[model samples]
Target chain A: MKRNPLVPIVVAAIIAVMLFAGIHSARKNRAARSPSVSGQVHGKDAPDFELQSLEGKNIKLSDFRGKAVLLNFWATWCGPCKIEMPWFVELQKEYGPQGFQIVGVAMDDSSTEDITKFVREMGINYPVLLGKEEVGQSYGGVNALPTSFFIDRDGKLVAREFGLQSRSVFVDHIKEALNQGQPVQAQK
Target chain B: MKRLFLCSLVLLAAAALGQDAPTMKPVVSMAPAPLTTITQGKASQVPLAFRVIRGYHINSNQPKSEFLIPTALKIGATTDIIIGGTDYPEGHDMSFAFAPDEKLNVYTGDFQVDVSVRPLRSVLPGKYMLRGNLKYQACDNAACYPPKQLPVSFEVKIAKAAPAPRKNPAQSPHSHK
Candidate 1:
């Protein structure tokens, strides 16, 4: 059988394009499969960002460099978020001086005034920041409410939780991060 | 020729077996109750009710807070209704075997969610729509089904407020009945 040389070249080009597309899509799928912050965050450097708190204070990630920080993303409209707000407040009060800090980034479309009012009503002790959608995307777009990240004293991302988490689960990660010097990386 | 005959026989048996399989269809049912609209002073007492079909549970406003499925509700722009928190009736939680050692949370049987709407001011007499979407991942005892977004729309009729009672018509301080 005689084969055309041009046919082979064209077939090779098609195969190459398909392979490239497949690889690109696979990478995107892998990124999407990475455990979202709502469930767990035992590994991965906590992506950091700076935003103004509801109190009109400049809050930065490096500001809490020497302390273990709990970064919680929540919204006023989310029922679970409201349910978990008090737990974060209690944690801040219990561990504030012992190198512990809770930072709440509210993902809400409402004005800062509304979020501040909600925080006041909830009596949250931790600093609450106004989370913008673009800013939230940098740390993995929060598909759900009550997503949280735990950073250790060494400024390493240690753990993540995707949904409403119990206080004990959060405290355990905080303790581990505080005790360990190295950052925990999320498994691929 | 014998080999070809055997292949034809096997294909016929397979087709017969396939016909014995039961067909399945997506099950969805929704119903809205009365009392959709209320007057200004009577807004706090109004209720918005729904009934879902058997063998399905709609995701409440909260669905683990990890998935992208968001429960949505829309009200008329002109209505000054204050929607209260959604209340989900408790149901038995069933487990599913997603993997060899993984389990998921789900609800089975009938459930109800109550929506309360309060009118801040007198509403112009007209018809309105209340729409809501429940995003849920349904599963039976063994296998989890694909996630579904069930949309429900209900109509409401707002009417003018009734006249108030006379200030001291019946309860006069000096009146003796």
Candidate 2:
């Protein structure tokens, strides 16, 4: 049949080039998926950090893209934080369908066992991540208990709260955050 | 004598500053407004009264459980004042849902902590603000909240010992009128 040997060589070269391009793009995607804390101010992009989840899995802030994220810093010992915990649970259920998520970062010095117990008793319905001192600083120094940051869908910081706020205040902010950007990307 | 008069003047000045400060929202309120007088080298009992919010109790300074955050009162260290000691009220033993078998020491309702202040002998007699903070972890039947620090302010005046009364010389046969 008169098939040239050079044809096989050319085919292989094309396949090699495509594979290389695909690998390069995948690496870029991973890099962008894990954002690090860089001390960005409000109106700027929210700095991100990776922390251990209550279940021991590593979680990153950038993993929450395409959704309106409520980053709340709290401790089990904080009374005000407990007062707002119920509201966050409700908000997660109400707005999650519309691409809203609550990521709780407990800036606690207590043992993981204590924190886990608190989370269990509260019946929290969202991701509970452990936050360190540097991570707290990245979110613009959450000195007060129950500090929260409202992030827009596009990953921009929108509003921040330092003390106990009424559920109405949170709902209004969530409404504004939900209205931001486009529909969220489907998760795998 | 000049030091005594000058210290009193300083105390008045500090009182004005204290007036300008806004009162904090109280989960526990201090009682009797912490105004006192302490003598140099002599320990004086400064009773600090605290009333906890109804339906809630706070962990005692020496909590029975190692994990429970203990309530504490600490006078900030300064050369102008020396803290002799403090008599914290014994916390009531109680069990919680989290750990029913483990009894934790806690305080409920109104309690008093008698803090002793011994002004350094060198300290001048004047009005001084006893700066301190009370750290406590509050809890109810259902849940335990994070620990909080309430700033403690006590205004104290240190008075100089009065000179011994001189005997009436003219009335005695030892001296002429």
Candidate 3:
């Protein structure tokens, strides 16, 4: 007995449909599981929060309301964070008088003493805050370390960087934030 | 009829015998072996060491552009010791499919990166965390794997520097030329 030639074609179509459904479901699942803060947070007000610094002093984001702020989230365990720490320190020293400030939120689970020791070892001059998971979630759930948010003087969020940023990149963003009051062309 | 059947059976047997046979197993094994080691020293200066498994090779710090495997040492921070700069062994030329346009640099076998930690004269003593990334690609004669960024973490004990050594120990023999 010979089988109908159309049987193979029907089987192939059913297999194709099954594959399409499987892929569609997988894409949806991935979208659901992916972190929400992976992309740029441009054109929105930077979320504000308060945390204690390594020195046990209270640090509030609104305290520097009229100044350009660089909110950097880092961890002692993250390699990229260490690389950019010195650069941030240099920028703070170079542009401090121009209404610029850098706040570092450390995601380290270590005690404040340990964090303070690390900051001193790295020679970080910026304020280092102890980051909590709840605070991180409020700021869009950071998935990677060294995520930085650039806030302008008007309290507008300007830019964000996810990984190691060159000194020039930070400098340029700081300059832009400082010049937000002036009528300047937007340069991204 | 019996003779005809016997002759046909003999022809079939001869045809089967003429076919090619599988080759014997070679004597050498090519799988890479696992590597692990521990070294301890003053927080200011800790000796970094690595052991390579037999049969496999890791790319050196300065691998060719085509090869992505980079050997690195991740050192945890110690009290006042400031650790900076990584020194690695040189690597040889290698090839990969991902970047077919270029030849990659890689090391074959075991390698190590020595890090120097300079502690301030009046710094406190304690354990600190030092972390870094090692980007590399593992490959054999037949194929090369994608570049991988392996996170490395190791501990260093902070202590007073040993008195001026009979052997100016600061001079690293494996210094990168």
- Per-prediction backbone clash count: 18, 4, 12
Docking class of 1: incorrect
DockQ of all models, two decimals each: 0.03, 0.01, 0.02
Extract clashing residue pairs from model 2: A77-B145, A77-B146, A78-B146, B7-B126
Model 3 chain B is weakest, by summed lDDT over 10 consecutive residues, at: B21-30
Off by over 4 Å in 1: A1-43, A182-188, B1-177
Span of ten consecutive residues with least summed lDDT in model 2 chain A:
A32-41
- What is the clash count of model 1? 18
Per-model CA lDDT versus the true structure: 0.60, 0.75, 0.61
Ranking of predictions according to TM-score: 2, 1, 3
Model 3 per-residue lDDT tens digits across residues B27-85: 11122222222122433334444544433345667654221335555555656556767
Candidates ranked, most accurate by DockQ first? 1, 3, 2
Report the lDDT tens digits of candidate 1 across residue range B23-52.
Answer: 123434445556465665454433434443
How good is the docking of model 3, as DockQ? 0.02
Better of 1 and 2 by lDDT: 2
Residue B54 deviation, candidate 3, in Å? 21
After superposing candidate 2, which stretches have Cα over 4 Å from the reference?
A1-42, A186-188, B1-68, B73-87, B90-177
Residue B30 displacement in candidate 3 (angstroms): 22
